[model samples]
Target: MPEQFGILTMGDAMITLNPATTGPLRFVANFERKVGGAELNFAIGCARLDLRSKWISRLGKDEFGRVIYNFAKGEGVDMTDVAYVEGHPTSLNIKEIREDGSGKTFYYRYHSPVLTMEPEDITEEMFKDIHIVHLTGVFMAIDRKNLDIVHRVLSIAKEKGILVSFDPNIRLKLWSIEDARAAYHDVFPYVDILLTGRDEIKSIIGTDDDKELADFAQRYSISQLVIKDGGEGSALYIDGQWVRKEAFSVTPVDTVGAGDGFDAGYLYSYLHEFEPAKRLEFANAVGALVTTVSGDNEGLPLLEEVLSFVNQEEVVER
Candidate 1:
């Protein structure tokens, strides 16, 4: 591990409006407001788990931006690099949740403040004392122009010898699969760890075969490949082998942000150098726990909560 345990991320934050009742957005009479963003959720999740989480991005100089900034700060996330822009309204999303707990997010991120971020804005000085840079596909998918910023950051991380962790949180609503593949291929060479979903990998590369996946990792020279299997558990590939763990049973209230929790758990464990199986177990537990609550990052647990949930001893060596 580096001299510091800080994890850095960048992306746009949005005000999420969830329906108060189970119905279509056209019929919903009431809604609950919350803050959400893939990278922001991961930062909050890491901070909750005792990691020094730092976020870098731009937000509109508006009320929604203030809410997101305050929320992340309240969660103990470092926001020294967050800036507010004028003109662009902060992005927002509307949630249409069904009776079965499934939901759809309608994004209103056009002219997003984050889009104003240029590749030149990312600098090596910004990565000082940062151990790992966590990135998600949602931000990359927001706009193809964002790819320049991502690539610039990856190059800096590489030059600084900082580990890079990526989550391909594919949102077809944002871009096409072909576009994702073309862009992500360039990113693969710079990534040190990959935290992805089972179905997502299939869509990204069109294969779920163990050998094929292993080959894919080898091609990218990725040291850690973690697959979130949802309720079935998770699978991890490291040190030339694979480790699988079953998921924890829980009554899910909302599954939205569970994967972000899983990424935080795994990266936290990886930073601590836990055994491979323990990493999967820990990540699975965090993901499971997130589903027990509503709102993004709301269910991301603190160190004590995770320890208790996993039935592990309280004093984990950091």
Candidate 2:
């Protein structure tokens, strides 16, 4: 029998901003706070699907930190590994959304509590029984100490034979392109499942085509690689086989968090033994569904909802 499914995701969580009404930025723009982090989004997605998921990070003793702690507990996530610091503020991000739903984001995470994580925070004992350990490139962009922590966790996970999933959720504003390339290259050798976007690969490897991206990941010994191409579809290369699948058509309200949702759905299906083709299809559907709402993770469909959407009579819902 396969081991019980459990995920250990490490990253910073931030507050997201959404415009109250369609308009430009005046003296002040109405915004709401919502959880916005690639790894946190994945953890929330896993919890929504009733998976055993844990988020490991340091949070401040501020109000925002309290909010995050309460929110995660309320969402049914395991908070046993979260550390609370005395004199730091939780990371926060601001997003600006337009009428058409396209948006831009600014992050304020310098010297945040989570980036202060030390290697001792993650121990080999933590990986003794976990099924998969998920990470992203954003953590690498935080700071050197945090980057070392990520490497430490990955090293221990590998030694314990735990499945390692990596998402190159590259944010150009966070670091220089050179740093992104060097860090990703260093971490790719340890990744078992690599998830990245077509545009990200194009920016790093100068390729936008599916086959090139898939081949590049395979060249690094990554057995399973996925390239997520928004709207056009997604491609998957698993065990020396390649499969492509299109996404469900929907009027996008906000593109934020769609890719993270895709990762969540793909990991969910992967843990459940779904075929490669079906896994791509399911991930695409989940990503497309997230675009229908205005906030990150707000529009993510549950397991039943995703299955219903997949089995519906109509392919595209207007």
Candidate 3:
């Protein structure tokens, strides 16, 4: 009776500002608010791929939180585990986008409800129906209490034989590098699959050397190790063999949340027990699709769309 996937994360619904000319926030007039968060993006992508995904988070009882709630509900992500904390305000970020799609982000989440998450918020009953629990390193490195909550959830998931997927979505602006590294080390033992970028692996694991990366994967007993390289390709290591795939070509509108989309595509394929090469190819297609549109999760493709892109065919039925 377990759902296909459960995600534990914090929501930072974003306000993306596209000014006529990017200069300063004060001078900008045009701004658009969109629901965004790495975990939510992942959930939305999975849901679009026709997988049952539940997202867990704590949000403030405010309009911003409502925006995220309404968006998630509309996107088919289960919000049953999300809590509306009484006094806190929802977290938000402002990103100033240039014409080329690259942007700078400023966050205002110091007192957001998500930062106040306690271990008690995650009940034992929540995981009883979750086949896979997805976590991000950014939330794990937020603070000690949040880290403890992560440990608790990971422990319970392990006890129930649920697969644990970790995305080391490292955010250096939120915490120090040393702390992030330590937190990664602490959580590695419980991780069944690691979805991370190649640069991130080098920074956190202390080496980009092929042999060392292989040793690190072996040491952690990671069943599936996925290394994503933006626009270059992705490499997958499983069953003691390595499979590589080239990134799909696309004109990027906004690069944010592309990684989350990739994760969703791979997880969807994984649940269906696809071959490693097929999974990587599907994942790359999904990631590429995200860049075709603006916003975080706006460009997540459905199953047929991704299949069409991968097969180099056009959508003729529509």
lDDT of each: 0.90, 0.82, 0.80
TM-score for all predictions? 0.95, 0.92, 0.93
Runs in model 2 deviating more than 4 A are: 1-4, 21-26, 98-103, 209-211, 313-318
lDDT of 1 by residue, 169-230 (tens): 99889999999998889999999999999999999999988889889999999999998989
Which pairs, if any, clash in model 2?
Answer: none
lDDT of 2: 0.82
Off by over 4 Å in 1: 1-4, 99-102, 312-318
1 or 3: which has the higher lDDT? 1
In TM-score terms, which candidate is top? Answer: 1
- On lDDT, the stronger of 2 and 3 is 2
- The TM-score, computed over Cα atoms with residue i paired to residue i, of candidate 2 is 0.92
| 10 Cα displacement, candidate 1 (Å) | 0.8
7-110: candidate 2 lDDT, tens digit per residue = 88998887766567665656335777787778888888788766788889888888888888888888877888898897778888876656775656678886
Cα misplacement distance, residue 258 of candidate 3 (Å): 0.6
| Cα distance off (Å), candidate 2, residue 99 | 6.1
- Across 5-52, the per-residue lDDT of candidate 3 in tens digits comes to 444333344333335567667778766666777888888888888787
The per-residue C-alpha lDDT of model 3 at residue 114 equals 79
| Predictions: Cα RMSD each | 2.8, 2.7, 2.4
